[model samples]
Structure formats: C-alpha cells, structure tokens
Target: MHLLPSNLIIFPNWLQPEELLYLDLERVIKTIATHPDSNKIILFIDTTSIYEEDADLVVSSVLMNLLLLEDLDVTEEYEISLLGNADRIEWESIVSCIHARIILENENQELLTSFLVKNIPSYKVEDLSNIPLGQLVFNLSKKLFLEERWKEAITQYQKLLEMQSGDADIYWNLSHCYRHLNLLDEYFNTLQQGIKLYPTHERLHFSLIIDFRQNGRIQEAILSADHAAKCFPDDYTFQLLKYLTVPSIYDSQAEISFYRQRYTQGLQNLIQRTSLKTTEEQNSALAGIGRLTNFFLSYQAQNDIDLQRQYGNLVHEIMAVNYPQWCVPLSMSKLQPNNKIRIGYVSHYLHSYSGTLWLTGWLRHSNHESFQIYCYYTGNEPDPITKQFQEYSDAFHHIPDNLPAACEQIIVDKLHILVFPEIGMNPQTMQMAGLRLAPVQCVAWGHPVTTGLPTIDYFLSSELMEPKNAQEHYSEKLIRLPNIGVSYPKPYIPPVIKTRSDFQLPDDAVIYLCCQAPFKYLPQYDFIFAEIAHCVPQAKFLFLRGTLLQPRLKGAFAAIGLNSEDYCVFLSIPERLDYLMINLLSDVYLDTFTWSGGNTTLEAIACNLPIVTCPGEFMRGRHSDSFLKMLGVTDTIAENEAEYIEIAVKLGLDLAWRSTIAERMSQNHDRLFDDKACVVGLEAFYKQVCSKH
Candidate 1:
C-alpha cells in the first residue's frame, strides 16, 4: 500500500489470495485523520487485501480521496474497483464515491445482487422482504435499545414478535420498555405472557414480584415471593424476601416473641454460613442477610440495643474486609487550625425527604469560608430541594450506583469529617457507612437509632431529644448538640379549606389525629388508644395507612376491649399538603410511642395544634417531647403511660384547656419553628471536634 497524505493511507500492493476480507472501518477512520497529503491519486489493484496492513488503512485512503475530491473538478475521473465478495462490501458509499462507473460481472451472486438492488435507491428502491429476517430484526432492535429509544425499540421488538411468535426474550424486552414508559399495567401483562411462554424462567418470576411491589400490591408481592422460595429452595434470597415481605405488624405478645426468635436464629445462621469465606464472598452472602436483619431490627418489638450492637459488629467485620481503613487516625495527629475543614455529608435522602428538612438549614447558613461542605447523594431521584443542596455546597457529587465506585470516589475526595444523616434506611448507604472513609465518621438521628459500628466514631444528636443517661444508648461517643442542629423553614399550609365531610368525618366529633405511619404503633401502645377512647367518647383518632398494618392495629384494639372502627378512622396516605391540612384540622396531635414523629412533630407545631407526648427511654421515642419542651410547653409531656392517656383525654374534652394550649403553641411558634441557634451550636461542636484532632 502506498501511504498518502491528506490524512489518508493508500495501498501500493494488491491483495494476497490468503488474506482476510473484512475491513476494520474504525481503524481506517483513525488513519485518514493523521496522514499529511490531501491531494493524491491512489491506485488499487482488483483484489486489494483489506488485510494488507489493516483494513483501516484502506478506509483512510478512501476517505482522504473523498475529502480531496472537493478540491478537484467534479468531472475528474478516479477509476477504482473492489473485487472481493461484493456482498461483503458493507460501505456502499465507498464504492459509489471512488468510482465514476461500476460493474458487477457475477452470474450466480444472487444474494449480493439482491442486497445492492434492494438497498440502493437509484437501483431498485424497494422493501427488503427477501433479506434474512432475523439478522435485520436483531441488529435494528439491539441498536434502538442501546440508543435508549424505548418506544422505537418496542416497535422493533413487536415486529420481531410478529415474524417469530412466542419468543420469551422478546416479551421480556417489551416488558422492560413498558416499565421504562411507566405503562405498569402493560408491564405486568407482558411479564405474565413471558411467564406463560417460559414457565420456569427465574428472572421473569422475580420481576413479577418486583412489579407487584412497585404498584403497592403488598399481599400479592408476598405471595409471589413465597411461591418462588418454595419453588427454589436453595436460593436463600427468595426465602429472605419471603420473610421480609411479611408486614412488620404484631397482633399480640406471642407473635412478637415468635418473630424475635426467628430473627435471632436467622442472623446466627447467616453469620455461621459466611464465617470462613473471603471478604468478597462474605459481602455477597451478607447482602441478603443485612436486609433481613435491618428490617426485623426496625420493628419496635425487636428494638434490642444488644442485637443492634451485634449487627453493627458483624457489619464492621465485613467493612474491615471490604473497605479497609486506609486513613491515619486524625485523633493521633497534631495539626494546624488555619486550613478550612473539609466536611462531607453522605446520605440517600438529600432530596425532598425528612433528611433534607433537617439538614438543609445547616448547608444554607454554615460559614462557607470556615467549612468546605461536600454532599455525596446516593439517591437516584433528584428534586428541587436536591438542587438547592447542590447550590449551597462547595462541591456536590451524585455517587454512582456501583458500591466500589462510590467508595473509591469518597476515598479520593479525602473528607476530614464524613457524616451520614441516616445510614439504616438504604442498603447501599448502610454498607458504605460501615466503612471508615474519612478521618472522623459520624452519624445523626435521621433514622434516630444507634449505628453501633466501631468505625462510627460519634453519634451526633440533639441535647433536647436524648434521655438523661443517653450515653449508654449508643455504641459511639454521643455528641449532643443544642436543639435539633438545624433551623427549619416555615411549612406551607394548604389554602383550600377542607371540611370534616371531605374526609368522611362528623362535624361534632373531636378529631385526635395520630398521623404517624402504621409501623410506628407498637402493640404495647394499643392499650393507650383504648384508654383515650374510653375516657373521651367524642375523641375520634385519625390514622394514615402507610403500611399494611391496619388489621394488626385493629387486633391490638380488640385485645384492649375496644372496637377500632368506632374509635379510629384509617385514611389513605396523603400528599404533603393534605397531610398538613389533616394536622391543621385535628383538635389534637397524638404522637406515636417509641418511634416518635420527627418531621410530623415539626409539622404539628407549625400547624398550631396541641400535642400530647409521652417520651420514652431512648432518643428515638422523644422527638415530639423534645420539641414541646423546646417551645416551653411541658403540661402535655406526660411522665408515664397513664398521663399520656390523661392529657390526650383532657385535650379532647376541655375545649378551654385545648384553646389555652393552642394559644401557648401559637405564642412560642417562633421558638419552635426556626431556631438558628441550633446551627451555631452545630458549628461550635464541629470546631470543637476538629480542634481535638
């Protein structure tokens, strides 16, 4: 090959008979861009071996000739011929552009002749019905799928289905398209069809369960998982899912005890099975185990500090293997204080969730010159508030879905202090939080429970929220900041005034709204509801059915000799505005025991409703009590369960007393709403912690 300039390579030699015929077009393009002389007449023999040096060299020669063609006369004759299997000529443009006249002299090349005739508009300009159907369909559909043109991909797959009936893979692809388009009904139908076509396909069965769960058909989801587990006994993941999908609702003390036993036995078995494995092997096994353990631990009945600590220790062992501590401990080093401290916040809930509501104020008002804030969001969905957090931070990163990639990026960022607001809610973040990725790793009360990981150096909490002896509650050093550590913006009240009839309530009834999720209601607290109902006949408690726990709630009520239907009305999950409206409309806000409402408590205050709180032994149970105390309203903070019922009933019957409490709430609204001193306290704590290092 004679190599020419103009970023083109030309072959000076003819093709050898034994060479491969395929042209690597990608390499040819690279050659054409780097050669020097643009204008050159390149000669090619009839049988030019694309394998001479590389087919890329031939493509470069041809492309260069075309580029220099503009400089020459249009009538300038450049005679070139490629005489290989003509059907193998993938690039028709090269054949058309490099020659003034073309001739095909094959008597029996039917496929090649037909292909050119069908594809070239000037020759035949016809449909390709005679072409092999499967190749064309596969290539087109695959291309469309790769480009993410989901609708067009669906159309291509549909055409494939018409040509080849009962293809399970095609149905799978179509179902995926429906899912991406949010045509959930179609997605389900397609998956069902796929399952019919290929009955034992594990992926399709698993996907059916996922689709059901996504659409909120919890019972069906559980059934599907249960069936899958029974079908595939060796796959512990399906069995784990079966256990997990069972609603965290206990009807009585017996059920609670039974579940606790199962949870403990399950954890011990998982730990033993993965005991002698390598770290990667252990991590793979622990994925399902971690989820099962975390879910059971979250239920109020299984909230044992020792079990939590044990879970943390197991997680720490995995972290020790998977994400080894590579950083020198900051506490051991003496450093100058002139440099700005690099603080990074890691969480999956940096969007319009509870974590954002509590942490946004710190980002908005923190002294940027003193602290460099970096937010690493693991959440896939980003909202307007997520953008706000991005704007306030010095640097923001959306951590990739791949766990190792996210950890690598965090390690590269080299944060001085890494804070995870709530590590328990998401598996990926929880796994990452267990790793020591920074000098100082701290966790906050977004989930409002101790992480119990040895890698977690400190538990950042509010002084008001914790009990008197809170140090014993956490595995890490408990650092209590003043107030809740952030100033909250005023919540929006819905403008359209809703009436009692809008929610199927009687006008004469005294509405005591218990707006917490159903999972927060412990069976132990069910008697309190019965007591309140008995004490105040007009007290109608409102609840939101966020979980599939209504039957359990009613069973608990029945245990206490009360009819749940007469005492309580369960409402569907509402939008933010509707939820606040319900809070505003109610006569009193009854806080849940144990897992108290952190965000709802703030909402109750913003709506100026009288709240009755009974704080518990742990910080998780005392948020509303803390808020009430912060606002200087202690009358409703009951010291015991009896007092909780007494205060709720008093607020129910004594209209004047209710009004007085409401007035006091309204008067101290500013104190409860936007306490900027909280941020100052947080900053001081941050400085103190850094100074120690």
Candidate 2:
C-alpha cells in the first residue's frame, strides 16, 4: 500500500466503528478534498476492518495525492475505529501514529472534531432509555453547583437521591449545597441522613461536628468531634478539631489546660510529619497553631499581647490579598430631628443579665425632658430590666431580627448618637455598629475591649474605666463620663456576719471574695490568689456561684492545684446585689485580671469593702485601677501578680489599715454616686454628636 504522509493518515481508534459504516467515512473525506486550498483536510475514518483492504489502499492514495498538491495544503484526517475482534490489532499502532503526528504539528482539535461528526451520535447514546438517569442527574447537579446556582443544584441532587436512594456521596454533596445557601436547618437534616446512610464516613462526621459548633450546640459538637477523632485517628486536622471544639463546651481553667496539652501534642506531630523548611508550609503550620493559641488565650482572664500579635500577624498574612471594610466620616446633618437630639442604644444585652442593669439607674434618673432616648433591643429575652429600660426611653423598639435590619431602622429613625452597649462581645451587635447606623456611635462597658471597628465614633469611658493616654489604643473617640463608673440603685442591704457563717466559712476568717465570672481567672491570677492563700492562712477564698461557675469550671481550678476543699468556696446568694454587698463579711475583695468588675467592684466599695486591682494595658482591664485611684486609695493598686498577692495578704493581716482604706473608699463612693455629674457629661457628649460645625 502507498502510505500517505503521517499527518494525513487518520487513525481508526478515533472513530466509533461499531456504529458508523464505510459510507459515512467516504462522504467526510470527499467533502474535505473538494476544497483544494483548504489549509487542513480532516478525514474521519471508521475502524480499519470496516473498509476492505483495497478500499484502505484507495483512501491512503487519495490523501497522499492531496498532500502533494502544488499549494502543499495541510491535509489531516481522524480515522476513529472501535475495538471489535478484528480492529484491536491495528488500534495500538494507529493510536501511536496519531499521537506522534499531533506532537509534530501541535494541532489536533479540527481532526478530532471531524471524527466526532461522523461517529459521535452513534455510540454516544447506545440506548438513551437504558442510561443511568441517577448519574445524569448527578452530573447536571454538579454543573449547576459549579455555576453557583446552589438552590437549583440542591433540587437536582434531591431528584437524583429520590431515584437512587442511599447514595452517600449524593447526600454529602446536597448537604454542602445547603450549607452554601445558608440553609443551616436543611444542612443539618441532610447531614443527619448522610451520617445514617454512611455511618463510617469521616468527612460527614466532621461536617456534622462543624455544623453543631456553628449552631451553638457545643455539647453535641464535642460528641461529634469525638466520633471524628475515632474514625480518623491519624488525621491531624480531626485531632485538632476535637481539641479546639472542647474548649467552647468546657470553658474552664482545667479545660483550658487540657486542650492546651492536646494542642501542643498535635502541633508537634503535625510539624514532624510535614517539612516546614518552605515558606508555604511554615506559614500553614503557623496559621494553624496561631488559631489554637488564640482559643487558649481567649479563655485566659488577662490579655496576652504577644499571643494577640502572633494571631494578628497570621491573620494579616492570610488575608493580605483580601479587601478591608470601608470606613468613612459620617455627616451628622440629618442626625438631629427638628430641635431635638435623639440617642439610640443598640444591644443584645438589654435584658436582665446585662450592663443595662447599670443603665437602669441612669435611665430612671436622666433628664429625659431634654433629650429623647431610643432603645433598640436585639435580644428576644424580655425581663424586668428590659421593661424598665423601655419605660425609661422616649421611644423603644425591638430589633425584630438581626443587627443589619436593626441598623437600617436606626438610620431611618435619624438617631444623632447610637450607643452600642455590647460591641466586641455580640457578633451581631458588632456587625450593626460596623454599618455606621448613626452619625455618632458610642461603645460602652457591655464589652471591655476596643471594638476594633472604625465606625464607632466614641467610647463611653469614666476615669475609672480608661486612664489618660488609654484612648490612643481605641478606635473610637473617647467621651469621659464624670466619676469612675456609673452607679445603679443599691436596693439590697448588706447581710449581717451571721449570713456569711451560713456558707460554712468562719465568720472571723479573713474572707477574700471574688464574685466575678469564674472564666476570668487567668493562670497568673490563680497563682496570685494561691500565693495570698499561702500568706494569709486564715483567709478563705469565696467565689459566688452564678451562671459561669459550674462544677466543671470549678474542677478546672482543682486541676491547677487549687482544691475546692481548701481555698475555693462556691456560694449562691438569693439576691445578687444584696449578696454582693455581703462582701463586707469578707474584709477584702480581689479583682480578676482583664475584666475588672464594674457593678461588683462598685458594690464592694459601697459596702465599705476595699478592692485591690492590678490594671492591665487594655481599657476593660483598667476599670478597677481607675476606681481605686479616683477614690484616693492608691495603696490598693498592684502593678503585677506579686504586688497583688502582697496587697491582698497585707489587707487580710493588718486590720487597722484595711479599716482606714475602707472608710476612705466609703467617702470616694459618695463621689461616684453623683448621677447628676454623669448626666451632665453624657448630655454634653449627646450635644457634641448632634451639633454641626
């Protein structure tokens, strides 16, 4: 046989020979040759066996002649053949020739298209009715998913699962689609089904765990995490997930230590398994460890600057390519409503258990005849305090939904100053503040940290809360209220010494009481108290039990060598304020680091109980420090853990000095109760926000 040029020789394997006949190939080849000046002639052939040996020779001869034309046309042909009994022998040889020619010419699409035109429809659907519709539906669903049409994709996958029930992968994909759509309930329901169908699937279990965590079912999340750990024992990601999830459920000093140990072990294992010599690998490891470190630091009572900086650097590195939120100067022209200034307070903590409890006194006593107060409560829980705040306001509105919607309403209200009582603490509240709903948005004591959002115009601070130069670290403008902190109506009278004996502690034992949240016990603060316990052997540490001081949290303290029997006493008082005033039974109050007690510290000072505070670098941390200084009680200031222990012990030991400080603190307490002064400062701030240049 006279062979054509290798480029012009179409391979049999490219054709669907089982379906296409010889006539199809002949017509395709003739069409290409008709155009002599065509740069490329694509000829698609069926299997070599479909044509007789003589016919093959004739086709080869025609292709060779076409290649030799005076114009030297670029002639190409794709000869596709199916592997029947006879064609298998030539399939390998033809495929090798086609690949070689493709490499030489660097062009194959035209030739491939010609082959498809002749034979594709024949074998593409051998019997369309017999095709697996489930698979077809799955493929269609995947296409929709890639297009970001999650709802449409979910519908298609649902149809596929209905047709072929118990497909684990289908259910998994459907769950993923629901998650993308933010249909959390549907996501969990689908995941439940997926886990039921494929109980052994580790990825599905991990997804369930993550969903539980995000939805606030921490205990269920921990259980799911344990399941994932068991299924994927060697997977470092799963192990880390378990370690990270445990802290959210059991947020105690002991749990913190437990998770820290696991984190360190898992981190070591990950480092050893992965080579960190490259920048990418090092960065990934750093990011992972940095997240774990943050979780641990978050549970600590004190802010760790080094730890925070590490986390911030890692976040910046990861998000360097992403855009940041736009912060613009707001125009207050529309903030004031026709000769009246409207102040809006947005918070999720407006209920009974809130800093709003402190605001109740101010609200009850404010000169409401001048400025109008509007409260936007995002929380659903209605309590006496919430009702009181509503009554105090000129106009009160429930947020009805979330922060964004609430902010929209606040903007419509044309509020001159919008105050955020819960800033960094409530995620939704922070999101609302980020929207810049008012011309002047203020942050307050509901959260102790700098909101870190630039939209907040000012921070409601007192000399006791944020000292001089402290405002530099905050993003908001500082508005200093008169006195150290706001005072609420002290309704509960201090219980007598007999009430203290009922808690089983000696009435005479120098009591060192801390009614703050148990989570506030930083490791260093724990050591400080432990040192004090060692110094003042007769002193008993009393921790008033509230929402945070559970048995598990107490166990955490036990793990750190402070036994419940020895130093820790958990007592639940009938009335919080009344019980708080009973701190008088305890000679001295020890303030926790990071979150210094506002109401609790105030109550302590009011009941003539002197509090020793060690202020940290942050605003939330400096409240007690500021309060002590404003009261002219500088001896109560402790610069570090050692000083905290020293002062605590000295106060417990020296009866005369303790009584003198308490008497002095009582006089300072009188200054703190000047609600009129606070009102004056607050009114000025409101006017500033409402006044235009």
Candidate 1 lDDT (Cα, 0 to 1): 0.67
Estimate the Cα RMSD of every predicted model relative to the unseen true structure. Answer: 15.2, 22.0
Among these predicted structures, which one has the highest lDDT? Answer: 1
Question: What would you estimate as the lDDT of candidate 2?
Answer: 0.60
Predicted model with the maximum TM-score:
1
Clashing pairs in 2: 11-79, 12-80, 12-81, 14-80, 15-80, 15-81, 43-77, 254-556
For all candidates in order, the CA lDDT equals 0.67, 0.60
lDDT of 2 by residue, 1-693 (tens): 221222123334323342242333343344444433222222334333444554456555555554564333324433322223234445433332220111111212443454322222121212222334344456557766776768767866776676568477778889989998868889989988888888777668878886686554667777877777777665534555665453333443575567555545544453345444556654444333322323323544434333333323333332222212213445676533546677788777788764667777667777776677888888898887788889989888887545446756776887777887755455456446555566677877666555545466677877556656766655566777877546555535455645665667776788888787655655434556556766777777787843334444345446555654576676767676547546767888988887677777767777888798989767767777876776678898998878888899999999999999988877765555535667677787678666642
Which parts of model 1 have CA positions greater than 4 angstroms off?
1-247, 275-283, 286-293, 301-303, 325-337, 553-562
Q: Distance (Å) between predicted and true CA of 39, model 2? A: 87
Give candidate 2's TM-score: 0.54
Candidate 2 Cα RMSD (Å)? 22.0
